[model samples]
Target: MADPVSVDVPHKLGREAARARIAGGVGKLADMFPGGGTVEEHWEGDTLHFTLSAMGQKVASRLEVFEHHVHAEVDLPPMLTLFAGKIREKLAKEAPKLLE
Candidate 1:
């Protein structure tokens, strides 16, 4: 295992709205991964954080929505080095789609 990679994404909505979008995005991820693990949600001020854990490995991500944009961070698991790029691409495509 190696150090985790952090990914930040931006959303165009408020905290609550971003949270909802994140929930849906996570659900999409769960479906995409299937039995991979679990997704957890958290809140801090206007930021919505999500953590995904599975097979003893975990990925911590965050979504923050400001007045004009939303910021998101996705931490890559060390074990996922090989598939990290693919996973990021998939998430990038799916996350925004879920918000819609």
Candidate 2:
């Protein structure tokens, strides 16, 4: 089995706001990629746990919201690096719009 490749991406948003935005984004992604996977969200204190899985593979994202920003760490399959890259690109482009 391959080790999961992790990527950390930070977003500029408050804790609650970041959780809302990430949940919405995950919903959008699920809608766009139906049957591709399942997305789950949960919060423990200030940390938000988000996960997507399919075909025995999983992508996990942990969001830690600080006073000034939200730090997100995404772990995915090594073979799916391109897909992850695309997600990062999309998030970089669309997150600000969603936050606004």
Candidate 3:
């Protein structure tokens, strides 16, 4: 395991709307990745737990949905550390659309 690539992506759509958007866009979300991994989501209270696996690596994240923003902490495997910056950059660029 490596230090996680954490991000807080703000969304104008409140918590409920954000959650609905995420839940409904699971397939589109998967397609964002090169290999299109499987997505499994579980909720604990207001936090959404997500696991995306592909090419033997798993990215686990906890999304805390708030009234005006969504906070996410992502744990990336050690092997993927080298691409952390690129991954974070891509996520930052794509997050707004995903949350909308």
Candidate 4:
């Protein structure tokens, strides 16, 4: 895989509140995808682990929640490497809202 893209999204809600908000907003994101997809999510202590598979591409991500920030690491499939910038931009824009 290409080097994983890392994004640090800051939130003012504090870790617990931010974690709750992110978890609740995930279902809304499912409806925004162009085509239907499967998202499998789990938690490892305070970190959230997720795998999103759609249109033959898979993105595995881990979000580490902290008091004032959430650090996200996304592993994009090789085929999707070229779109990394767009993907990062989208995440950079949306992550904060999700955490809020």
In candidate 3, what residue range of length 10 has the lowest lDDT sum?
A: 27-36
Give the alpha carbon lDDT tens digit for every residue of 1-100 in model 3: 6778777888888888998887776555555444548888898977888888745787787778888887777787777677778767866777668776
- Candidate 2 ranges with C-alpha deviation above 4 Å: 1-13, 20-26, 29-36, 54-56
| Residue 8 miss distance in model 2 (angstroms) | 7.8
Candidate 2 lDDT, 53-94, residue by residue in tens: 744566666766665565555665665665665656655554
Candidate 3, residue 9: the lDDT equals: 86
Compared with the true structure, the alpha-carbon lDDT of candidate 3 equals 0.75
lDDT of 1 by residue, 8-92 (tens): 5556675577667656566555543323577777778767676776556767767666655555556666666766676666666
Model 4 compared with the native: what TM-score? 0.88
**How do the predictions measure up, each by TM-score?**
0.66, 0.60, 0.86, 0.88
On a 0 to 100 scale, what is the lDDT of residue 15 in model 1?
56
Q: Which 10 consecutive positions of candidate 1 have the poorest summed lDDT?
A: 27-36
Candidate 3 structure, TM-score to reference: 0.86
lDDT-best of 3 and 4 = 4
Once fitted onto the true fold, the runs of candidate 1 whose alpha carbons sit more than 4 angstroms away are 1-16, 23-25, 32-35
Tell me how many residue pairs clash in candidate 1: 6
* Residues forming the 10-long window of minimal summed lDDT in candidate 2: 27-36
